[model samples]
Target: MKKSLICALVIYCFSSVAAYAAENPSVKALLSEMSKASQQLNYQLSYIVINRNTIEPLRYSHAVENNVQLAHLVYLSGPMREIIRRGGEVSYIDSSSEPFTIRANYMVAPTIPLLNSNINELSKYYDFVLLGKAREAGATCQVLRVVSKDGMRYSYVLWVDEKTKLPLRADLVDRDGDILEQFRTISLAVGDGVSKALGELQNVQLPQVLSLPQGNLTHTYWKVSWVPNGFKPEELNRYKLSGTNQMVESQLYSDGLFDFSVYVSDRNDQSLKSQLVRQGRRSLQIYVSGKNEVAVIGDIPPETALRIARSVKFSPVAAKKVADSNAVNNSPETDVAPESSSQ
Candidate 1:
């Protein structure tokens, strides 16, 4: 009997250690390493951006030599719109539109942040529990389920390449069980063979980014009346355009794993609004009526978007009714909402 008891204890000890290791692996460390590697290492990626309205396979070639981060994106089929990003600025020369320039952060750059940076804020809205071992990008990886803490943002499943600590694929879903976005690694490389032209931009000067002076924002400006419990804040900044006088109040909120952006404006006479746009895995919704206009942009199920859109209320109304309630943003004024959306 004593022998049997000893064996049971050994098994239990091993199980406990395994459980701890699964949850305690260096997520932050691995992610930091991945970010550093992408910026300092030389590599190339060939992936497909499968959007709802279109599916165009694309390739990105990047090289980081001598402290420069240079990369470009080229579509395989359709009109080839090329974007070259170097250092802190990005220039896009598209076949459809005139070339333009903009300052961008390494996190939410236009092409795709999934490749350029680490999802550091993911833990705020998700429990990054290990789903055990897996294989991806011709290397070992850990399968992690970025489960959502609330309905405001969607859940994500990710395959983090074990060797490189880079995310191989990510799936975006909604509350009613739908995939709003899927970024998979069809092929990836780690070693040399990076071309200098990948980061090369035509020797053309770009206009200085427009500065409206009121572009700076703080947490005080985003006194949200309501947000899902686990939804993390993804971004909050102003969008200032040249040759325009209207200034916008912008905010971004996410649940660590899932994310969304909200824009508030004093109803411009654009003559169009209260609509949503579905771009492949990405989605954009505009809520406009009377003198108020709000735009919620992200990649989540349409129903979730609708719920989030309706849940938004002005600060004035939030103060009047939700003094005692926990959710001042989701007050009674937004009770009636959409039932479904085709997108």
Candidate 2:
């Protein structure tokens, strides 16, 4: 009887350990699988990006040949726009501009970070949670939620196909749980070999790579007063405006998932009026302060854009003094500097 009791206790303890080991997998594991599937599988995806007021249909195909990755994207509506990716170089073909190529590992598209970014790095700003399972695109999908820890960035709901381990749908949601934009796959086909069309696109002669003008990288005279949580300065450069051809100071910031560009230009007759514009998942906020015009544009909420725009500031002793004086006098309608020698 004593031996039987000891055996029963050991059996119970082993069963408990087995149950714990069989618990649901970690969110990071699921994301890692999705990332691997995106890069390793030969698949074609037809999807639609739905914004607040408009829906744009797009198609994407990815394949690998001789260990080289190739992908293509085409806008199914409106003007002709296409993108082709060969290895690390991406070429843009559009009706509005001449074809150009840029060096990037992944094409600029929704949920691209899942395919190219490290999950551990992104976890610095976002917390991933498994929200259970659902059916999407006629297949079982594991639903996951990515929430910002500080509420400075938007959150996302991702549906990853269980069978293929690929992303099926994603929704960008605001703090209030309102979905600002959504990407849903209408059809998906996976194969063991590259498609004939993808092989031809891989061999097509792409246009010359556009050289981006090098700018002074040491300039630190201007800075943003307030940055959202997890965001860091990516680059600061001076460039000529496309339309006005005026020299402008620009700063880029990113928080792993979202990116925004800030442009500070001398106030001119062509200066954009203070206004807010929302198109699809992007927002543009422009305001004029003294002799400087500030524009903040990104795929962020309008409120967040406005706050960032109001936080642009000048550095150093003299500029700070002038900025403080302006704040005290309340003479300007905006928070940016009246005029800075940095531009």
Best by TM-score: 2
lDDT, candidate 2, 196-252, per-residue tens:
669888669999777775544444335677767777776567555566546566778
How far residue 7's Cα lies from its native spot in candidate 2, in Å, is: 9.9
**How well is each residue in 1-343 modelled by candidate 1, as lDDT tens digits?**
9999999999999999999877558655655566666666666666655445554566676776456677776666777577666667767667787776667644233233345544566555555556677786577877766665554456666677776666666666556556655666678776655654543443446545533333233332223445566555544454434576444556666543346777766576673668878765567878774566767787665666666677665654432232233144433222212211111
Runs in model 2 lying further than 4 Å from the true structure: 1-23, 110-113, 193-196, 242-246, 268-275, 287-291, 315-343
What overall lDDT goes with each candidate model? 0.59, 0.78
| TM-score, structure 2 vs. true | 0.81
Error of 1 at 223 (Å): 7.1
Clashes of 2: 0
At residue 318, give the lDDT of candidate 1: 34
lDDT of 2: 0.78
User: What would the C-alpha RMSD of candidate 2 be, to one decimal place?
Assistant: 6.4
Provide TM-scores for the models.
0.65, 0.81
